[model samples]
Target: MTLDDKKRVLREMVLHRRFEERCYQAYIERKIGGFLHLYPGQEACCNGVMEAARPGHDYVITGYRDHVHAIKCGTDPKVVMAELYGKETGCSKGRGGSMHVFDVAHRFMGGYALVGGPFPLAAGIAKGIQLKGGDEISICFLGDAANNQGVFHETLNMAKVWNLPVLFVCENNQYGIGTAIHRSTAVLDQYKRTCAYDIESAQCDGQDIDTVYEHAKTAVDFVRSGKGPYFLELMTYRYRGHSMSDSRGYRSREEEDEWKQRDPINILRDKLIAAGELSMADFTAIEKATDDYIENEVMKFAEESPEPNVADLEKYVLA
Candidate 1:
């Protein structure tokens, strides 16, 4: 990556890391309720792909672990934090909580609750775009565990048959909750499993933001070229547990330490420093600023934002 590209990636990675750190702190402090999923280690997969695409045109949808995706897609941290706080100022008016954050302005479809809920929705969105002869494409992001969903196969077949402009991004973070991938998936190679539908697929290192960006860009472009749907699998690991309540006894400390040694943010920070593209002082200052932004702005915004009124309880709720 060029110096400018590295800078962009670093900035986003820092924001994601800091934001997630603060979110975890708030959750522990009892300021934010409901299930909270942090995106600390999976920053590269979300930020790298969003960097290579136009959020104004393309639609981005993902599963429950979506705060990072929303922030990267242009949703302010304030509203996002407010959502976690169950305040009306949230993206979904505090109704969606941690999972469902929908903002049409930035084209972030939502943080769907179900593992495989967004597959058909992504295809439907792509179909709508195609009918209008629009150039924009749709991105469907999910976890490795979601690939095992029946809807995943059905959606892939339909997308291919209809030649929809969609890119399915699977962030394989080794294990889903406590179950290892091998225990759940018969086809261990998530990318090649798409060959059954004759869709083009590839895999990349999720730790290297630039590599993920390049591969994701190509896949996004391929889908945008009016071709059928494409699938891109990213091999990554989450340093933290799957959720706030996960006991995490299923993995070993040595395994977690092994992945930590290859941390994406650390890898980029080291590379940028060695290439003379970033100084240690600037790195410290940048991270400090990100911390300040989340601590001061995001926290205060969520704190001051009013909770949803009981009288309006039925306002956003669907029948």
Candidate 2:
């Protein structure tokens, strides 16, 4: 990536961090109701991967920690905030708050609320692409805990068997809600689990945007080349609890502090500064601009947008 490209990604990562921080404040103030998950430390995982893949062109789906991913995939940030606020102008028309943000026009399929639910759905999308002879690949982002589900194995096996172009990204944040992964999952290394299905896999430091982008670029290229499925496990952490309601009492403060020291945003910023590509003043300016955009634009739109009409409550129901 060029220096300018790195700078752009740095700016984007800053925006994502500030956006999620604002969401946390909104949730606390009761403006955003229901199961809000903030992606503070995991900014690089979404930004880096999206940078490697064509966001608006390729198919993207993930679990409920999805606001940042949707934005990276070209969904309007204002509409995402509106969705969290349950406004009629939301991406899902305010019907799918927090968890089910969807914008098919941009090909950001949807964020599933059920754990492991997106596994097979991603495969199905890839199968459709194969049948249609399309070059687009389906990307599924899920947490470490979701890997334990039956669908995880089933999806990988089927993806390889049919040579489906799908990339399964595991954001292994080390904890599933309140339980550390080791307590719930037998194999600690998430990438190694793909060995059962004979699919190629790798793991990397999720806090470093450069590292993620490099590895993700290779994985994306491999999958898009019609080589079947690839699994990438990113070792990262979430600064907040699993959801707005989670107290996060299961984890220790020392562990959280240690992870915070290697924060993704800071890693990229420091790297640029050391390389003489960016100055502290430039970073401060980027922060201010992002803050203004989120507050003046994103928050304002969500706050002023109209709530869903009472009579139209059944609008998008499939039944």
Candidate 3:
């Protein structure tokens, strides 16, 4: 990667990390509500891939654990905080909460909370693009546990049969809720699941931004060229628990520390420093700027936003 690209990734990853840490603080202060999922250690998965995607053309849809995706897709951080606070000024007008951050303008489809739900939705979106004769693509991100769901299989089957323009990205963080992938699945080769539908698949070290971008770019290009769907298994790990409520009883501090040593953001920063592409001063400046951005956004979301009125409770109801 060029020095410029490396710097860009560093900035985005740092911003993502700080933004998530601030969210945790907001939850503690009771400034935000709902299931607060932190994307602390998985920044590279979202940052690098979003960089590779052709923004404004390709669509991104994903299951929960989506705050990173929202930020990476260019949604104003303040609005996202407002959404978590259930304020009227939020991106979903204070209705969607933490699990359903949708930004139509940026082509970020609904951040569905249902396990494996976005897989088919992504395929359907790609089908729409194909039917309309547009060269757009959809990238569906899901957890490793989601790969076992029926929707995953069904979506892959349909996508392969129809030759839809979509990329199935499985961010295998090794565990789903409290169950690790090794315990949950007989075969741990998550990428091989795509072969059942005869789709192209590749696995990459999700902790490395450059590796992810290189592989995802190739997979995305294949789908964009009308060659049908492709799949990428990003072997990543999350530092935080499955949700804010986790008691940390399921895993040990030692295991967590081991993964922390391989932290993606720190790894990328070290690489830049070792290559003499960035200095400690530059990184410190970036960190301060990102910290200020998150803090300012939190205050902005809290001060200027209003909660939803009671009358609207049954207003958007479809029945």
Best by TM-score: 2
TM for every model, in the order presented, reads: 0.97, 0.98, 0.96
What would the per-residue lDDT of candidate 3 be over residues 1-319, giving only the tens digit for each residue? Answer: 5789889879988987887888788789887787977888788887767778876567999987887787777787788878888888888888898889988898889799888888889999999998999878888988899998998899999999999999888898888888878888977989988888899999998998989989988998898889999999998888988988986677888988988888898889999999998888989999998888776766675557788897888766696
Q: TM-score rank, highest first?
A: 2, 1, 3
User: What are the Cα lDDT values of the candidates?
Assistant: 0.89, 0.94, 0.85
Residue 242 displacement (Å), model 2: 0.5
Which order, best to worst by lDDT?
2, 1, 3
Tell me how candidate 1 scores on lDDT: 0.89
lDDT of 1 by residue, 1-319 (tens): 5689788779878988888888889889998788888787888898778777786579999998998888888899889989998999998899899988878899999998888899999999999999999889999989999888899999999999999999999999988778999998898889999999999999999988888989998998899888789999999998788889987899999998898888899889998999988899999999998888887898898999898889997885576
- Candidate 2 residues 1-319, lDDT tens each? 7889999999988989999999999988999998998899999898888899999989999999999999999999999999999999999999999999999999999999889999999999999999999889999999999998899999999998999999999999999888999899899999999998999999999999899999999999999999999999999999999998988999889999999999998998999999999899999999999999999999999999999889997776786
Model 2 spans > 4 angstroms off:
none
Q: What stretches of model 1 exceed 4 Å from their correct place? A: none
Between prediction 1 and prediction 2, which has the larger TM-score?
2
RMSD for each model, in Å, please?
A: 1.2, 0.9, 1.5
1 or 3, greater by lDDT: 1
